[model samples]
Target chain A: MKTVYVCSNTVTGIYSAIYDAWKARKGEEECSVALRGAVETELFCEYVEVEETVHKAQAVEALICRHLGREAYWDIYHAVLAADTGKGDAILGAMLAAKTIPDSRRIMEHLSHPKVEKVFELSRSVIGEAHFLKGAVRFRELAGGVLYARISPKAQVLTCLAPHFADRLPLENWMIYDRVHRMFVIHEAKKRWILVQDEFLDPERLPDLTEEEKEYTKLWKGFVHAVSVESRENLKLQRQHLPLRFRPDMVEYM
Target chain B: MSSSESMTTYTYEGIPQYMPQGAGGLRPSMFQKLNILADAAKYDVACTSSGTARSNDGTGMGSCERSGICHSYSADGRCISLLKILFTNECIYDCKYCINRRSNDVIRTSFTPDEVCTLTIEFYRRNYIEGLFLSSGILRSPDYTMELIYAAIYKLRKEYNFQGYIHVKAIPGASKELIQKVGFLADRMSVNLELPTAESLKLLAPHKTRKNILTPMRLVQNRMAENKQELALYRNAPGFVPAGQSTQMIIGATPETDFQIMQVAQSLYQRFELKRVFYSAFIHVNEDSLLPARTDEGPPLLREHRLYQADWLLRYYHFRAEELLSEENPNFNVLFDPKCNWALKHLGQFPVEINRADYKMLLRVPGLGYKSAVRIVKARRVGTLDFSDLKKIGVVLKRAMYFITCNGKMLYPTKLEEDYIARNLLSAGEKLPGEVVNMGYHQLSLFDDVGFSGKMQQYM
Candidate 1:
């Protein structure tokens, strides 16, 4: 029998834990698997704790992103996080299994595997949002070398969102904080990355809100409003394209 | 004031792609300039990252995932996810078809390196685009024009530390050194073939030559190869063009057939490792007498779409140019997509037992998109995927049903006849605007006053 550790939060967090689990597996210690964000009773094996480390997290990220391939990395990340089980060991085992198989997208082992379904569904939603938000989301520079913004997604999609930002803004001094999850991704490519999770997010805490932000905010809002023509006041079409839910956060919608 | 900047749609009424000034020549706000440029640029369907190798090196600033990003969509019904704009609309080369040609009498403008860097960072921050897609008409000299473009890209990537996707166009006559410099900074670089054939280029665009155009393209391809080789040898070779290089060919411009265009595209990919080959449909702009007159009916937009489909097939589906078209047939079928049409010709290959068909065979099936082809591989391993299961997963059976079989059973009862199926599929889409216009759209327009249609056809 083996003890399984579960990590059921973000892709980075799970990846960080994967680094730990892989190391343990290589050792003489017994290893087992479970999904994150899960709670249950331990039968026999002693539970061991692994703290998140940047070095371990970096290795997992590099392995998935560099060695594994782009699409697979996305699929595994989504699948790993979407599974409701907090048995981190199980998820990690499944992820490791996925890596070995050339064709990783085998839906799920079981039909009702929440993580597998979540991975598929969330990836789709995140991709769609990323495409649209590539236009809708606005970013501004905050002090402390952080680029800050908020994304309101329909499907729980903070995990899938970071890679796009990470890929595009890797070298840039930036941070994308998911307010819904109270998590933030800090990326300074080739420099240092700090991912803050399960912590308080104070919007005002981000530095560097100068006059430029104020002016651009007003300007962006005006541009969006100006583009909406009264001649074609098709609220249905407008709402179809830009939903009421997203408008609260977006300046153009406002 | 530029017509594009003033009015809504580009009806080609006044100078298109120009920033409209209000009243007595007032400067438009930066936001308004972007709207105009974004709207103007939405039509250029060139910013793509597919059919290329992935970024394996850890040394590059960033990489372009196989799935492309559309920073934003402009009014012209294309992605504006990139900062698509001209370095300067002030062109000395009087390409008759260009909106920004010297003789067009339009308001000219240029953006400095600093200005471009600021806009890209700003738009990128707001999540407006992935990066910059910068192109320019020949300004001053080719080298000089190229220098400004390189300066801006380098400034954005180097100075601002911007790792966003930058797709820059290399001026035909630009120096090899300059092209290499930008190649290092840009994720993707392209030199527009502009016209399909050398003949059309000579006739319509007398200033540009085949040698001038292909030289820079060849140079970039060589440098990219060298970079990859170096990576293998040293594992620390500096990145050249991480996204690789892609080129554009203006469709419907010349008398070149889809076969000829595909051959060029195939050679570019084989010779240069091209990421993509964009096919921009020609829309007439001038009254260049040397050009064949295209009637008001316009260049074949459907043909252009089909060419793109054919291009995709050539690049990914492992379909060869000879397999797709011949010198006799030349053009793609106006109705069915190239993949479906190709499969219909080779019916013997299908019904190969989905359980056993290889990746290449599965890719050949109609309705199996890039993803579906990939999906079929995984699903079959769990168990032999039946026709019903394929549909449940994602395959569009409407088209594939005609081509494929489930466990040696054809879906339909009737005998398979390629001709019969093709005709039905021919009348499938809208009547293709006008079918019986036997002559090419250009031939009929010559007698009628040489209108905009004639000029754009040269580049098409």
Candidate 2:
């Protein structure tokens, strides 16, 4: 019987499912994994809904980090955050390839393998989205002097962007709210940042920019307008570098 | 030209307080000043926002990271909008290629230090820019202009606590003391080598000489070297141009060949320890007989592209100027890129066995980039890589097919003949950037076509 472990789309959920599937030892052929909410339930197949357990997830994470190395572990970790529903299965495929490949630690570098390539493709896309958000996400100084920025990224990239801002703006109280994921990473001034998932992120509740913030925004608009050469104005090229989707949140475009 | 008396001086008092009337007699608002200064600054192409990794100290608003972030790309596909503006467009020198030459009847403007600081801090806070790339026309004497630049950046760093990457130009003929003072505050600094050679400098920019440019570059390099030593000894010794310095050479404005340009770049890297040598394609903005005719064809952008390709080969690929071009063949083949052209010339190096070749040898193969080569080196250790495996490894089999062998066998039966490979390579459509191809002029004209119409009639 082919056992398909249906898991939640989160990294912890996928790792938990991977742990349970490995414990069953049905090997590569009999057992498979699928991310819940990502795929439709099949009619006749034996489906196992893997429960989320921290211990199980930690064990699987430790095993991958130890056996396949940190690079592959991070690749799988970031790929898991991808919006693709098939990412869970891709991780399973990659883990299987890692077990079988001779130099298992360097399995991620084996791009010729379909399993490894799938993980890289997902990771690249997720990382690429996070990189764009790093440059594109604009913050407004709220009335309380807290920096507030909202990003409606396609990928679940809030966690990925948190470390960058935390490192760069260590003393600033800032919150990077992800609209799609209904999650946020908030860092208090000189304190550690924490990621919280809450569905109460309403645009109407966002405070207006302070008077200083308003002045800066106007000054920025003036500079941006002046900087572009009239003769060499190429909107098509500009669109290619910074796509149209990112512009809606940009202060200059707004 | 080298005399101190020859230098023109424009003091702070010498600058006009308001907008000099032209182009709509509206009172020059701050916005209008920004527009004119920014428009004037656009011709400069070196707007890189990389090199420094200054972290925020909590009090300030920004941080500079190692890899540069491009905020926006211009219509030419060049990165722009980095708060790149001239401190002032008022000039003393009369360089023929310059839009703000002394002879030109353009609107003159200057940004006060306080205004420049506010613009940089504000734009940075909004995430509209990576950092500031501040350049200027010679407002007065080089010393006076350099002093104004120093005053502006001094406020941005010390007053505003703005820690973002700042790339400022070190005005040639500025006193060494002022350049050093500004050097400590800036992340990166540059001196423009307006024209490639001394003779070209003499012909166009009568006031500026080759010495005026090279002197500041050498000064920055020396200061950066000293700063490195001091940094090693004292942890908190403020880094002097921590990102190092770069210089720009205007291409196609002068009659220098690719060979000469590459040699200049090669020597600059070896001698000066410069971070980058920017190549600006000459856009004919002035109506001087000394300048090239401005046809709709625009600048020699294609030639500039080829030179940049060769430059990468020099920096990363371990190739030299002499190897890529000689006096006999000083220009790159317009049909093929530098790498492929080299591969064709040295056909004996072809059919490198994929598994057996070292990392360096693999890099020379057509269609194999540094990343793919590194991947190949890593992947081959696990198992024998076949042709299909090579495809999955991101190797462009289209070009690499002629150059590499898998498992002691060619992917297909192929000849090592140059013309055969060149024909195949040509048919594959060189896969250059679209802008490069769009800027290209046809080498053969339809007007010069003899029997091409006769051949067309056969199809008709």
Candidate 3:
């Protein structure tokens, strides 16, 4: 009979499930991980509820960093943040497969392994979305002088975008809200950034924009319209690159 | 026409404006100036913000990404990476193709250094642009125009502490000292080639000579080489054009073959050490007899697209221009891309075994991008990759199926003949350009030699 460790759909929850499954000392075929809501009950299978904790997640993170190396650990970390429910099981399977190999750190390069490939694909997708959101994230100046941006990314990408903007706008107070994930990445001027999760902020309730902000928005829209060549207009190609999903928040589109 | 009188009347939003028009001229507001300058600069076509990655240094309010970022895409589908604009539209040269020629009666205005700085910083703060792309028309002289541009960027860098990407144009015939000073402040610098050949330039732009343009390009190239050594010696040495330099040529303006244009691009990459060579399809903005006759056919966007595809091959795919086009075949095939056309022409190299082929060989496969080719090589080392695995690796197997064999087996029962494969690839839903598709397949047979027999044929 196979044993499935069930946990919530989060980095901490997934890592804690991996921790419990690892401590079971069962063979790779005997144990698996699944998200709490996404798990389908299998016949003659032992389902264990993982007691998720910060310490367990930290221990597993350190274990992977020490054994599988930082590069593989990074892929696993991003895979856990992916939207796919299979990501937790895939990551756990990849980790188990790594132990069988002579060199565990090179597990990501074993792309032919189905579990490892799943993790690689998931990590690539999460990073790809994060990279796109880095540029697509737009900041509007509020009446209070803080720069606020809202992005409804597919993955929980607030963590990835915060450091990039924090480095780019070190002197300016800025905050980015992930509407889909209901999280916030807040950074004060001349200070480090912090990620706040489970924040319920209504999308329609953003503060009023500054007078300068409105003027600049109008100017930016005009500039976008002016810069395009009238003869070479191709809405299909523009949609291909910019995509329709990111248009709602963009000032030029608005 | 005095500068003092124009300045007082052009005030807006408490910021003093600089107007270059004579008395009785309407003082265009900031909105109008941005519209005019941005519209004028749109034709230059080098808006990339890549090549340098610098953090904000904890003092400034900007940083650069090595891969660059697109803040927005215009309706024309061009990436809005930089706030591309002209410092002024006032010109002394009557270039035949230019909209802002000296003979033309256009609104002539200049952005003061402060105005340029404020726009860049404010726009950058809103994440509307990656940085600034400052080009200008000749105001009195090349040196004078270059000095005005230098003043704006110098303030943006030193006083405003803007650490963002800045791409500036090195004005042709500007003093070498002034050009050198501007190079230190810009991340990337370019001198427009204007036209592919000297004869076309002479006919189109009477004031710009090949020597005048290449001189400043050579100056930046030499300075960048020296800056590399200085940075090697002193870690914190101020760099000159750290993102390197690029140049652009106006295609279809003159009677230059695609082969001739590509040869010029190849030499620029090899000899001049240019980072990029942009090809702008000549749009008829001015009515000049010397220019190509205005037709219902818009800009030669398809041709420009092909050149860009070939340009990517030159830079990334380890391909030479000669491999892509020749005097016998001066233009790219309308039906297939450069790589697919090359593969079809040389079918003897077909059916490369995925399990045994090397990275370079995989890159030549019809539908294998560099990324997927790399992934195939890595993944195959761990396990054999079949057709399904290739699809999983992001290879467009619909096209690659005709060219590749996985584990000594083709994806489908297909002939190795070029005509058979080309027809199959066409039916595989390869999205042809709208112009080609709209022309209808029956008409395509008559137009098979589209580039070889059209207006471009006269040049050949």
User: Candidates' TM-scores?
Assistant: 0.69, 0.89, 0.93
| Model 1 misplaced stretches (Cα beyond 4 Å) | A1-136, A140-148, A162-211, A214-254, B1-43, B49-68, B290-299, B348-351, B374-383, B419-460
Question: Which candidate, 1 or 2, has the higher TM-score?
Answer: 2
Q: After TM-score superposition, what is the CA distance of residue B197 in candidate 1 from its true location, in Å? A: 0.3
Q: On residues A1-254, what C-alpha lDDT tens digit does candidate 1 reach at each position?
A: 56555444555566666777677653323554444435465777655555666677679867767655676566555455442444244445455555555665542432234434445554455567655654455567564545677766543455455655665555566666666667776677655556677788776665766577766666544433433323223456455655567655565444
Error of 3 at B101 (Å): 1.7
lDDT per residue for candidate 1 within B164-231, as digits (tens), equals 57888889998888888888877778888877788888877788998898898889888887898898
| Position B246, candidate 1: lDDT | 75
Q: What shift in Å separates residue B173 of candidate 1 from its native position after superposition?
A: 1.3
Q: What is the lDDT of residue B52 in candidate 1?
A: 30
Best by TM-score: 3
* TM-score of the second chain for every model: 0.80, 0.89, 0.92
* Model 2 Cα lDDT, one tens digit per residue, B1-460: 1213322334444432222333344446777788888888888878887887777777776787788777655555566537899988888999999999888988776777888998887677666788888999886589877888888888888898888888899999999998999999999999998888999999999999899899999999998888889989999999999888888888887778888899999988889998888897787788999876555655666577888888888888888889888887677666667888889999998789999899888988989988888888887887888988888778999999999899889988989998888877766775754443543354434432122233223212
The Cα local distance difference test for each model comes to 0.63, 0.80, 0.87
On TM-score, the stronger of 2 and 3 is: 3
Considering DockQ, which of the candidate structures 1 and 3 is the better prediction for this target? 3
Q: How good is the docking of model 2, by CAPRI class?
A: medium
Ranking by lDDT: 3, 2, 1
Candidate 2: segments with Cα more than 4 A from true spot: A23-26, A40-44, A53-59, A100-104, A141-146, A209-222, A229-236, B1-27, B432-460
